[model samples]
Every structure is written in C-alpha cells, then in structure tokens.
Target chain A: MELQGIYILWLRDLKRYIRARSRIIGSLGMPIFFLAFFGMGFRRVEIPSLPQNITYIDFLAPGIVSMVVLFTSTFSGISIVWDRQFGFLREIMVAPISRTTISLGRNLGGATTALIQGLIMIALSFLIGFKPSINGLLFAFVFMFLIAVAFTGIGIAISTFMHDIHGFQIVINFFVFPIFLLSGALFPISELPKFVATLALFDPLTYGVDGMRWAMIGYSEFNPLYDLAALLIFCVTIVFVSAALFSKMEVE
Target chain B: MEPIVVKNLTKTFNGFKAVDSINFTVKKGEIFGLLGPNGAGKTTTIKMLVTLLKPSSGEAKVAGYDVVKQPNMVRKNIGIVFQEPTLDLELTAKENLDFHARLYGLNKKRREERIKEVLKLVDLYDKANLQVKKFSGGMQRRLEIARGLLHFPKVLFLDEPTLGLDAQTRRKIWDYIIEMKEREDVTIILTTHYIEEADKLCDRVAIIDKGKIIALDDPENLKKMVGEDVVSLTVNDPERLIDELALEEIRKIVRIEDRLELSVVKGEIMIPRMVEIAQKVGVEVKSVSLRKPTLEDVFIHLTGREIREESGKNAFWRR
Candidate 1:
C-alpha cells in the first residue's frame, strides 16, 4: 500500500513538473545563469591544491548541479503550502494511508523533481565544456539524489508550519541562499576562515558540494567516506523529522 | 449495519470546544445532514467522523470501526468532499480522480471503470481531459464529487457540498448527489446551512449550534416541532406593528434589523389580518412575505436569532 502511494504521488509530482512548461523554463533560468556567468567569469582561476588540469567551470559545474538540487528540492515545499490552501492536502491527509506513507510519497516526489533539475543542469554543463566519465555521472546521480532527499525534507518540514505561500517562500529562501553561499558551492571551503570553516562542517550542503567536486572534477578535501556518511545521516535525520512534523499538519 | 454512530464526541481547539459532546446514530443508506450556521461545529463534527480530526473526548464509529483507534479503517470506508476546493487545479479532471483512486490503492482495471462511472454520474465524462482550473465552479465541484466517489466508499461525506454555488448549480449538484447516493448505495452525511437544502435533500438532520447538537430528527418531524409558517413583515414601524398584531396569537416573533418575523400556523390566513392591524396602527406595511415553515424557522424557534444573520458572508453567491 505504501509503495503504491509513494509511486503514484511521486508520479503525480513529476507529471505536474513536466506539464508546467513555464515552471520548468523559469526554475532553470537561475542555475543556467549562475553556470554561465560564474563559470565564464572564473574560467581561468585555479586553486593551488586542485589539479592543474581542472578548470574553474569544471569545478563549478558539479557544484552548480548540486545547487540545482538544493534550490529545486527546497522550493518543492511550495507545493505543500499550495496543497494546504487549495485543500488537496486534506484529501491526502484523510486518506486511509499512514502519515509516514504520505510524507514519504511527497518527499520522494519532491526529491525526484529536484534530481531531474540536477540532471538537466548537469547536461547543460556538459554542453558548455564540463566533462565527466560515465562512472562519474553515475556516482553524481547518487550524490545528487541524497542531496535532494535532505533538502526536500527540510522544505517539507518548513512547509508544515507555513499557511501562506508567500511566507513559505520567504522562509525557504532564508535556508536556500545561505546554504548555497556557506557550503562553498561558489568557492572552496579550504579558503574560509577558521570559524566559517567549522560552520561549513555542519552545513549539510557542504558534504554534497564536496562529494560532487570529487565525483566530477576528481578533487577531494576530505575522505569521500565523510561526505557519504554525513549526507546519509543528514538525509535520514531530515526525513525522520519531516515525517514526524507532517503528521501534525491540521486540515483546516 | 449502522453506517455511523457517535457518543459524547467532542473536539477542542486550544480549549475552545469546537465539537462538544454530540451523540447520534445514522441508519444505513440515509442522507443525513448537520445543519447549522458557520462555526456551529458542523464541519468539525464531520471532520471527526471522517477521521480527519480526533475527538478530544468520547467515541465514534464509522462503518463499524472506531474512528479514533482505527482511523485508517474508518477512512477506508468513507470519502469526503471538503468544504474547501480539494481538486488539483493544475491536473485534468480524469487525472484528479485517477490520483485519488490510486491513493485508495485501486487497481488499474477497477480504477479505470470507476473513473468512467463516476464521471458519467456527474455528467463530466466529456470534459474529463480538461484542466480543472478551466472548468466552471459548478463543474469543478462536480469533479470533486466524482473524485470522492472514485473508490466506492461506503460512506460519503459532503461538507457544505453546495456552498458558494448559484441556486441553479446547487440544484444540479444536489441532483447529482442524490443520484450518486441511489446509484452507488452509499450512505451520505452532508453539512449545510441552507435550510432549503437540508429540507429538500436530507432524510434526517441534526441542527447544531455552538458545538452542540440542538435538535435531531427527520426534516418533517423537526419542522413539526416548530409547526409555524414564517410571516416576515417589513413595516415602517415594527415596534408598533408587533404591539397591534398581538391578536394573531403568533407563536414566536424574532426582530431582525428592520424586519419582524412572526411564526404562525396559518401565515396565508394571517397576512391580511396583519396588514389590517398595520393600517389600524397607522404604520405603513412596506412589504409582507409568507414562507412555509422550514428548518430555518425551526432554528429560529430554538435559537431566538436567524441563522443567516451571524453566518459569515463567505457565500455571497447564496442569493
């Protein structure tokens, strides 16, 4: 029953995303712009410890894909706010299924949408001279999915308390921009001051960015195990918290 | 088996008892209504029965399953058309029904057949592929009903199903609803403030107020309890008119704004005498209208105030 629910709901979200041509076109604009300007502006720059063969765009490409996942997944919470306002959430909540099932469906659905956004960005980056082996692409898929799950969980958790869509966006943006900036998606965490670097260790996105960097550009500041462990732990924690929070959402 | 049973069911929201201890039992295959003004806990009561809200105290069962302890079982037997619009506006009508069916774990073959059946029931089969946002308000509501019936639930909950629709649309929806009940053999629990709707559609009604069930009976019996047609008099001077019209032996007189509503068994016979009294008292009778005794009169007889007055003006389309 739960498997079917998650499948159907996940399909529903994907179907909606596919149908909303404006949304697909609109959400892609920021990530593509960041890749273009940032990648182009920093093209010649190279970090000292990074391999000499790696260009700035190559370094930024995987991080940009992770950025797409972060923004898209967190923004997926907007659907919950909308579902509440439009009354669809009530239908789902009142169904025979458990709240955990409902939350899992929604989380997986949101994460899938975010992963698709990541894939699109990765493909776009590939066209603009960002190259990776098939093996790297496969691993990037896993890392992007993990990142998607974590942020989607964050999004759903935030949305449970937000009655207004405007308030939801304002709050999610509070998470999205900071998580992007502080996670060293735009720059290396190695260059940060001591306290800021310490904070980066706590930012879940930092692990995602480092994982992506390792996968795509063959660079790593820490053992890949740390990234995998940290992201998995964060993903599970967020999912648990989101499922608990979503159970308490009132119909009215 | 009885489709629904409630005993001392109550729900409190932050200490405000939204659904006070209410007891009722609904026979199978009946159109039951929770009729009241807004905030009278009609919606709250339905929420509890549908397993959307938990009772703060007491017990209820739907489809022979306890609502609190076996909410999933209760939900399995019931479908709800919420007071708010629950359809996915972005999706087509068919997709909405299809998704809801899948959520209920309907297999593909049964899902397809039920979708076609329900859509045809609501006469929305032709517009199955249209986006719900593009559909008229009435069509959207009908689609919602179709979605609710997708899984063939044993009990269907219509929470103000006809709210915010025009009279014509409401009537059409009512016809579809009755048709649904008969065709599907589903027990329906409806909540409505429209006295006429409760009178026309509900086999039995429980009039609620301030989180309590004030009266429960078939519409005929409840109206018999009041047993008076409502004669509303818009007079130039109501205070003087009431004093002069004392000979009519009015059962109840509720003064609302500039209108005086008099309850009497023979409103048709009394209007002429009321007019004569108005002339005798030198108060110009602005307008006089006689209405048959309805659930509204029953409500006014019990509550001392008109139900329509305090209810929010959210349904501006009511007229």
Candidate 2:
C-alpha cells in the first residue's frame, strides 16, 4: 500500500487515457452531452413538495456526475481484460510483488481516473445552469470517489467472468445498463411502484445517487443519513468481495 | 548447489496433463535445455518452475525455494522471458529496464548502472532511449532479455528464446546468452524446438513428448545412445535392399519410403562399402549422406514420430 506504487499506476492510467484522446472524450463526453440536453429539456418539470425549490436540472446534475464516475471505473475494468490478452498481466504478476498490491494498485488507478471524469462532468454541469452549495460540491467529490471505488470493484468482478471482449460488451449492455436504469440515474426512485422502489433501495448505485443528490440539491424523499450509511456499507462489502475473488481470477 | 530441483512435478489441465510426473535437477552455473515438440510440455514445465503455473500433483524448488510454498521468493530469485513479447511497446528501452529495476526494488544508483550494463550486454546501448515499437524484432527481444537481467537473479528462464528470429539474429541472441551465462554465472533453463539450438546452448538436455520426458542426458551422450553415425541413402529398390542390408552385423536398419537409415561405427568408410554393395545388387543409388546422429534422431527414436507432427495441437493463450 505504498503511495508511490499507487502514484506510478495512477500516472500510467492517466498516460494511457491521454494517449487515446478520442476514447477518453467519447467515454466521458457522451455522458456530459446527455446531462446538458436533458438538464435543459426538463427544466420545467419541478417537484412541488421538495424543499429549496430545486429545479429539474439541478436535481439531475448530481446523478449525472455519479454516472460519470460509474462509467469510467467500469470501462477501465475492461482494460484489465486487455492486459490479460496482451500478456501485460503476466509481466506484472511475475514481478516480486504481492498479488494484493497489484490488485490494489490497479483498482486505485481506475477509481482515480473515474473521479477525474466525474469532476469534468460536474464542471460541465455548471455551464448548463445547475447550481449547488460549496458544501454540496465537496460532498459530491467524496461521494464520487466512493462510487468510483465500489463500481470499479463490481466492474472488475464482471470482467473476471468474461472470456472475450464481445462477451464483456454483452455483459455491460445487459447487466450494467439495467443497474443504471433501475438506480434512478435517469428517473427518481420515488416515482416507481412499491416492488420496484423496494428493489431500487437495494441497488448500490441508488444509495450513491441519493446521497449525492441530497448533498447537491438539498432535497430528498429518503433520509440522507440512511443513504450515506448504505453507500458506505456497499462500498466496503464490494471491495472485500472483489479482493477475495481476485485471488481465484486466472487469465487462462 | 543446485539451482533448480523437481520432485515428481506435474500439472494437469482438466483431465489432460500438460506436464506429467517429471523429476530432474539443474546444478548451479549450468544451462539446462528442455527439448520438445510444440505440445511436448516444455513451456508448462518451465511455467511451473517459474511459479507461474501451479503443479497439480507434485513439487518443485527453483533457486532453493519451494515453488508452491515460497512462490514469491522463487519469483524473486528467477527472471523469466516469455515466448510472446511482453515489453510495453510505448515505453523506451531505458524506461522498460527502469520499470523492471523498480519492480525488483533496486536502488537509484545501482538501477542506473545495471540499466547501462544490461543494455550494453545485449548490444542495445545506442538504442536505449528509443521506443520499443520502432525497434526491430531482434532489438525488442534483446531488450526483453536486458530487462529480465536487471535484477541479477540467480536463475533465468527463457521459453523458446529464439523461436521466430532469423538464423543470423538467432545466432546473435545465442552469443548474448552465452556471454550472460559466463559473466553472471547464472543458471539458465531454456526450452526450444530447434535441435541445434539445444545442442549448442545446453550442457544437458531433456527430450520430452506427449506430456512426458522420454530421456535426459548431455547432448553428446544422447546422440551416442543412437550410435556414432547414421548413413542415410535414397535407393529405388526397397525389398531387395532390405534383404541385402538385413545382415546380422548391422545393429539397426530403418527403411522409409525412399530412404534407408543405418546405424554404424565408422560411417565415412562404411558409406562407400554400402554404396558398392548396392551397385552389386543393381540397386540404383539416388543420394547419399553420412553424419553423426542429431537430437532429432534421438527424439524420433524415443517417440516413433517426427517433431513436426505435434505443432498445431495447443493454441497458446486460449482459455
């Protein structure tokens, strides 16, 4: 857990991202575009009972930022698959380092990249007429980091099960997209039916989005304390599970 | 001291064993060659020794550390160059060596010194700052060897080191390998399909096939086991030739479709007498050649098949 190792891996990740300019933008840019268009398009739809008279754009901003962190972290897990394919994983594995160090370094690298992407989306939100308190902005940063760590683990776990790139894509489209939709990244969980709302309560991304929205727009149907607590529990559990499963993950 | 020792080592994939129960020891400052066909388990055996693949049934100790119980220690004591290119193409040659140096926890001054020395060792010092993507295949392979040596491990494992190189480049690599071995006194274990490569590079060789090692001895002794020389002659008459050469004096005579292979003590003089006898029997001689028995002949004698037949069975890196 040397910070130097983490920093080296972080630099490696950023360098890789910068090298693939179109991919970096495409992965983060498309989501920002949606945040802008939808935030503006839905300006008139306002919830009557919400405190602080939060606008629709302001309400959607936090969710978009959370989605940016989630997407970047999940996609970077595919990079692990590429590493395995290109023999890079073996190169690293053969080194005289603990497997835990290797996994931690990679996950930290992925999470850091996701946080940077989340920041870009947040900056973009300001240009699109969304407003939040300074305290809320700080909270958004912390929430994004936690979401990045949790989703990165889930993403890597998903990658371990896939045998090829095509299978990885199919998994993301089928599993990840549904999780995002069900977690209220596009719509409010309160508007869903009883069974769906109860199920959404269990979605880890739901807790993250709820906590972030509460911090940003200062309005929520669920208690912010509960949301924060659920997110912390979810993040810790996913991290442990991913680390344990990583030992059994084989390239061949 | 022995650099590598195996006690009934084996690795199985599902129901198929990739490395069967095999045991051998490599002494310090020695080059051990694992000679085999494509699917003859050389790579698997090396992987097990390098602590990359776990043995399914037995045990191995590399650099005096048990491969299973102390895998990290074993890995620390040995450097491995894989069959495929593993260097980061985007990184410069110096950067690649620097990364390996850091992985091995070398200090700054020593890391820099070792980088320069290893670059020179492989004769790539002038191209130290050049990116690997721009380097030729030979240069890239040389850089990989340089990186593997950065840690100054006690042993080095090279899996098919010169597999795809041209003959001239392959010879250059072999020269570097010999230089490295002499300079560092490092124990080297390499696997190869080329017979001459093993004969030239290894002090001793293990002939493996079908997940089993058929024989283990020095190259000279292995060749001697098949007799001193083999006289290969292409003859048109087969039945009459077999009847004529099937004398009690000859130890072994093998007949292919268009060739007669005979084991003899002095092939230089015996070849002429055999040709004279063939002419007396009116058997037209197409071509004649005589030489000492090679590692290929040793392999063929052990397995009853050619080395080229097992090339396409294993798809590397496939799940």
Candidate 3:
C-alpha cells in the first residue's frame, strides 16, 4: 500500500508536469540563456587556470547542466507549498500511507523532472561548440541523477517549513543564488580568493559540478570518487531530514 | 463497535480551547452531523478524528482504530471531503478519482470499476474527461464527493459538504448525500453551519457552540424539546408586553432585541390572547406570526441568541 501510494503521487506529479508545456518551456529559458551567453560571449577568451587541452565550453557545459538540475530540483519543492495552498496536501496527508512514503514519492518525482531538464541542457550544450568523450557520458548521467535527488531532497525539506509560495520563492532565491555562485560553475574555485575558495568547499553543487566535469571532459578539481561519495552522503541526509520534517507537518 | 467513538476529545491551540472535551458516538450506517457556526470547532474536531491533527488530550476511535495510537488504521478505513476543495484542478475528474483509488490500494480492475461507479453516482461520468479547473463550483463539489466515496471507506467525513453553494445546488448535493447513505451503507459524519442542511440530512445532530456540544438529537426531537409552536411578535415596548402576557399556555418567552419569541403549547390559541393583552396594556402590536418549532428556534431557545447572528458575526470576522 505504501509503495502504491508513492507511485500514485509520483504519477500525479509526472502527469501534471507533462501537461504544463509552458512551464517546461519557461523553466528551460534561464539555463539555455546562460549556456548560449557564456559559451558564445567567451568563445575566444582564455582563463589562466583552465586546462590547456579543453575549450571554455567543455569546462562550462557540465556546470550548466548541474545548474539546470540544481535550479529545477530545488524549485520543485515549491509544489509542496502549492499543494498546501490548494488543499491537495490535506488529501495526501490523510491518506493511509506513511509520511516517509509520501516524501520519497515526491522527491523521486522531482528528481525525475530535474533529471529530464538536465538531460535537455546537456543535449542543448552539444549545439554550441561543447565536446565530450563518448565513454564518459554514462557517468555524467550518474552525477546528474545524484545532483537531482540531493537538491530535490533539500527543496522538499525547505518546503515542509513553508506555507506560502511567495515566501518559498524568496527563501529559495536567497539560498539558490549563493549556492550557485559559490559552486564553481562559471570559474574554477582555484582562481578565487583564499576565503571565497573555502566557501566553495561547503557548497554541495561544487562537488556535483566537479563530478560531472570529470565525467564529460575528463577534467576535475576533486577526485570523482570523492565527489560521488559526498553526494551520496548528502542525498541520504537530506532525504531523511525531509521525511522527518514532513512527517511532523500538520495542515489546518 | 460504533463507527466512531469520541471520549473527552479536546484540542487546544495556543492555550485557547478549540475543541473542549467533546464526547459523542456515531452508530454504524448513520448520518451524523456536527453543526456549528464558523470558528465553532467543528472542523477542529473533524481534523482530530481524521488523524490530520493530534488531540491535545482525550481519545477518539474511528472504525474501531484509535486515532492517536493507530492513525494509519483509522486513515485506511475513513474517507474525508475537506471543507475546502482538495482536488487537483489540473487533473481531469476521472484522474483525480484514479489517484485516490490508487492511494487506497485498490486493485487495477476495482479501481476502474469504482471510479466509474462513484462518478456515475454523482452524475459526473459525462464530464469525467474534463479538467477540474473548468468545473463550476457545484461540479467541483460533486466530484469531491465522488472521490471521497471511491475507496468504499467504512466512515466518511465531510466537512461543510454544501458550503458556499447556491440553494438549488445545495439541495442537489443533499440528495446525493442521502442517496449515498442508502446505497453505500457507510457511516457518515459531516459538519455544517446550515440549520436546514442538518435538519434535512442528518439522522442525529450535535449542535456545538464555543467548542462545546450544547445539544444532540434528531431534528424532530430537538425541535420538540423547544415546544409545540413558536410565536414571534415584533411589538412596541416588548418588556411591557412580556409582563402582560403571563399565561399558562405560553411556556417561555425570550426577548431578542425589540422582538419577543414565545414558546407556546398551541400558538394559535395564545396569539389572540397575547395580542389582546398587548392591546389592553397600551403596547402597540406591530406583527404576529405562528409556526411549528424549527431547529433555529430551538437554538435560540437554548442559547438566548440567534444562530444566524453568530454566523453573520463570524462572516464579518472571516472577511
């Protein structure tokens, strides 16, 4: 019954996502814009610390894919606030399923949507002058999936405490901008000031960006195994935290 | 066991008692009502019973499962239609029902069958393919009702089933509720502020006020507790008229503003006597009317205030 409940919830979200074509297109706008602007605007520029073998797009493509997953996954948590405002959360809360099952289902759905968006960003990156090793593509998918699951968990955890969409938007923006800025997505962390580079170490997306860059372009600051391990721990911790917080949530 | 048993069920919010130790039992297959004005704790009590909110103290059992200790069991056996519409507006009516059916762990074959059956019961089968966002207020409500019964739950909780609907739509919803009771043979507990809704639909009603159950009985019996007939008179100098009309036939007279509501054994016989007494007392008789006691009159007789007045005040506060 719990599995069935989770499946139904996931299926409901998927159906809603598929039906909202404008939302899908709208959400892709920012990532695609970032990709084209940075990939084209800096086509001839040379960063001092960048690897000699790969162009800037190779270094920037994986980071843009990570950004897509990060933004889409975290924003998916807003659906919880939406469901609460519209009264659908009450229906799910009173169901026979456990809160853990409900949270798991929602996170899985969010992760699936984010993963799809990340894949689209990857495909779009190819149209630009981005190049990737064919053999590393599968590992890139693994890192992307991890990024989606972990950040969607974070989004759900944050959403459990939020009641309104406007507040969630403000809070998410506050967190997302700082996380994305410090994530080494645009520039290498090694080129940053000492204190700022240390801050990048705390940003979870930094590891995601490192892991995906290693997979796609065979270039990374951190070891790929270490990145994979850090993401796994983050995923487990966030999933548990979200489930606990959501279990304690009550609707009026 | 009864479908629901509540003992000293209390819920307090920030030290303000929302449901103050209310006790009641709902027999199997009975239509029970928790009738109260807005902010009168009806929804709070339902929330406790449905396992959405924990009770601050006391205990309640629904479908033979403790709400506090065995909430999942209680949830499995009960269906709830919240006061607010809970359907996914983006989904079609049929998809919403299918989602609910799947959550209840209904088999695929049974899911299809019950979805069709329940939607047809609410007369929404033809519109099942349309998105709920396109539905009118009344249609959305009917679809909610259909979804609530999709799982064939042992106990169904409907909070304000006909709230905010037009008179005709309200009547249609009431008809569906009554027919559902007969056809499904499931115990139902609903909350409403509408006196006519309670009087027409419930087998027994518990009238709650200020987080307390003030009266509980069938509509007919509750009215009988007031008197045979109620005579309402708007006369000048109501105090003087009350003093003049001290007859054995007049059981009780309650003063509400400038009007006097007299609970009499035979209102027809007392109306003329009361009017003559007013005439003799130099008090001008403005108007007089006699009718059998209704739930509203009973509420006024017990509380010394009009239920509608409380509702109106609540409406203002809500806005």
Candidate 4:
C-alpha cells in the first residue's frame, strides 16, 4: 500500500513532465546555451591551476551537467506551490497515506526528471565536441543522480512553506543563483580567495560538481569519496526535513 | 453507529471563533446538509469532519472513527469534493482517476472497473481520455464528483457542489447527486448557501448562522414552522388595512415598504377574505399573491435578516 502511493505520485510527475512538451524544450535551452557559449568562447584561454591536458569543453561539460540537475530539481518545487494554488494538494493531503510516503514519492519523482534532464545535457554535450572516458560514465551517472536527489529535496522543502507561486519564483531564484555560482560550476573554486573557498566548502553542490568532474574528466579538487559522503548526507537530511514539514502542512 | 456523530465540535482561528461548539449526527445513507450564508462556519465544520482541520474543542466521529484521534481511518472511510476545482488539468480524466485509485490502494482490475463505472455514472466516459483542461466548467465539476465517489466511500462530503454554475447546470448536477446517493447507498454531507439546493437535495438540513446552528429539521417541517402559506399583498394604506383585517386565520402580519406580508394557514383561503376586507375599508388592493412558505421565509423569520443580503457579496468574493 505504501509503495503504491509512492509509485502513483512518481508516475503523475513523470506524466506531467512528458506532457508539457514546451516546458521540457524550454528548460533545456539555457544549459545548452551555457555549454556552447562558455565552452567555445573560452576554449583558447588557459589557467596554470589546471591539472594536465583537459580541454575547456571537457572541464565545462560536467559543470554544465550538474547545473542542469540543480536548476531542474530546484525549480520542480514550484509545482508544489502550483498544486496548493490550484487545490490539487488538498486531494493528496486528505488521502489516507502517510505524508512521509507522499513526500518521498514527490522527491523521487522530481529527482527522476532532473536526472533525465542531466542525461540529456550529457548527450547534448557530445554535439559540442565534449569527451569523457567510457568507463567513468557510470560513476558520472551516480554523481548526477545524487545531485538531482539532493536539490529536489531542497525544492520540495522550500515549497511546503510557500503558498504563492509568484512569490516562490522570486525566492527560489535568489537561492538557486547563489548556490550555483558559489559551487564553482562556472569556474574553479581553487583560484578563489581564502574566505570564498571556505564558503564553497559549505555549499552541497560544490561536492556534487567536484564528484561529477572527477567522474567525467578525471579532474577534481576534493576527494571523490568525500563528495559522495556529503551528497548522501544532504540527500537524507533534506528528504526527512521536507517530509516532516509536509506532514504538518494544513489546508483550508 | 451513525455514519457521522458530533458532540460540541468547535474550531477557533486565533481569538475568532469560526465554528462554535455545535452537535449533530447523520444517519446511514442519509443526505444531510449544512445550510448557511458565507462566513457561517459551514466550511470549517466540514473541514473538521473530513480530517482536513483539527477541531479546537469537543469531538466528532465519521464512519465510526474519531476524527482527531483516528484521522487516517476517517479519511479512508470518507470522500470529499472541495468548493474549488482540484483536478490536475494536465492529466486526462482517466489518468486523474487512475492516480486517485492508486493512492487509495486499489488494485489493477478493481481500479479499471471502478474508473469505467464512475466515469459512466457521471456521464464522462466519452471524455475519459481527454485532458481535464479541455473540459468546460460544468463538465469539470461533474468529473470532480465522479472522482470523489471513485472509492465508494461510506460517507461523501461535497462542499458547495453546485456553486457557481448556471441554473440549468446546477439542476443537472443536483440530479446526479440525488441519483448517486440512491445508487451508491452512501451517506452524504453537503454544504450550500443555495436555499433551493438544500430543499431539493437534502433529506434534512442544519441552518447555521454566525458559528451556531439556528435551526435543524427536514425542509418541509422547517418551512412548516414559518406557516402553512404566506399571503403577500401590496395595497394602498397598508397600515390601515393591517388594522382592519385582524383575523384568527392570519397567524402574523408584518409590513415591509408598500407591502404587507401575512403569515397564515391556507393562504389561498385567506387571500379572498383579505381582498374583501381591504375593499370594505376603502383600501385599494394593488397586488395580491398566495404561495407556500419557503425556506427563505423561515430563515428570515428566525434571523430577522435576509440570507441573500450577506450571500450576494460573499459570492463575488469567492470568484
């Protein structure tokens, strides 16, 4: 019974993601544009902090993939606000299932879509002459999924407290940009000043991007094991917190 | 045990008492109504009974399960159609029902069968594959009603089921509600400000005002309390006509602007006598009409105010 509730919620999200053809296409435009402009525009530039013979495209590819996951997963929380506004959330809240199951189902559903978006980013990177080792693709997949799960949990957690969709857009934009920028998705955090590097250490996406970089291009500042552990902790904590908050949510 | 039982259930928002302590019960397979104008706590009481909101004091049970202590059990036994549209517009009608069925833990065969049965019951089977966004307002409401009954719950709570629909559509929805009650054999609790809706669809109604139930009885009996019939006459010099036409058959007479409303037994029999008395007193009778006492008259008699005065403004706010 519990599993069925989770599966149903997940399926609903998947169906919605598929049915909104314009949204799926529109959401991909920004990440791909970033990949092309940043990769080609800075292809000739070099930094002495780089490790060995990795090209700019190879370095920017994994970051772009992580960015796709981060943006899609965090933005998925807006659906909860929409559900609240449109009255669909009450239908789920009034159901007999536990809120933990409901939250888990929604988190997993958002993560799955985010994972798909990341995978599509990876595929699209190949068109721009980006390359990664064949054996490391599996590890890259794992890091990408962890990134998706962690941020989707963040999105759901934020959405449970928000009642207005327009207000949520303003708030999530404020959070998403800072987290993405500070996580070194656009540049190397090692080149930053002492205080900024320390701040980067606090961002969960720093580990996620570092892990993906190590998997996709064999270049990373932090240890892959440390990155994996941080993401796992973030995923578990956010999932539990969102579930607790959702259980206490009231509908009028 | 009854399908629903309440003992002094109440809810307060901050210092404001939205739903004061009130008690009522609903029998098995009965169509009970909570009738009131806006801000009268009808929605609040329904929310508490459906386990959506916890009461501030007292207790209530739905389908034999305590609402506060056993919310999951209460939720499992009851179905609700909220006042607003709750359907997922992106999903097809079938997909929406399928999602609901899965959440309720219905298996493959039963889900398919019940989905077909309910869609057909609400006359939406032909549009089952279409996305709900494409449906008109009346069709969407019908689909919601169909979805609410998909689980065949022991109790169904419909909050303003026919609200905001045209008169023809409202009547059609009423027919479906009545038909579903008989065919499904489930207890129904509906809230509405529409007097005709309560009178036509409910087996009994609890008329609420300002967080309290002012009256509770079958429509016929409640209207009977006002009088058997009411004779409304617009005559020249209504004050003099009132003084001259004092009869034992006329139970009460109240004068509004340019009209005298007489509460009487057998209003048809009293109308001719009233006209004759007005003629004898040299008072020219401009208009005379005889009709049975409606629930509106009862509401006015008890509250000393028209329900429509408050409801008309509230209806605009709802949109």
lDDT of 2: 0.81
Model 4: residues with Cα > 4 Å off, grouped in runs: B233-248, B253-261, B268-288, B312-319
Q: Candidate 1's residue-wise lDDT over A136-171, tens digit each?
A: 777778889999999989989988888877786567
DockQ values, each candidate: 0.82, 0.48, 0.81, 0.82
Cα distance off (Å), candidate 2, residue B185? 3.7
Q: Candidate 2: which stretches are off by over 4 Å?
A: A1-8, A46-52, B14-17, B129-131, B235-240, B247-251, B255-257, B272-286, B309-319
Stretches of candidate 1 exceeding 4 Å from the true structure: B316-319
Distance from true position, residue B236, model 3, in Å?
3.7
Error of 4 at A17 (Å): 0.2
lDDT of 3 by residue, A77-187 (tens): 658989998889888888888889999999999999999888888888888768888789899999999889888888888888787877865775689988988999998
| Residue-by-residue lDDT tens digits, candidate 3, B1-319 | 8999999999999999999999999999999999877888999999999988899999999999999999989998999998888999999999999998988899999999999999989999999999999998889999999899989899999998887787899999999999999999699999988889999999999999889999999999999988999999998799988887888888888999989999989889888888888888899988889999888888888888777775643322221
Q: Where is the poorest 10-residue window by lDDT in model 2 chain A?
A: A1-10
- Give the CA lDDT, 0 to 100, for residue B214 in model 2: 93
Per-candidate local distance difference test:
0.86, 0.81, 0.89, 0.89
Scored against the native two-chain complex, candidate 2 gets a DockQ of 0.48
Give the TM-score of each candidate.
Answer: 0.94, 0.90, 0.96, 0.94
TM-score of 3: 0.96
Interface RMSD of 2: 1.9
Q: In candidate 1, what are the lDDT values of residues B219-297, reduced to their tens digit?
A: 9999887656889899878887777776646877877767888888888998898898789879998899998778888
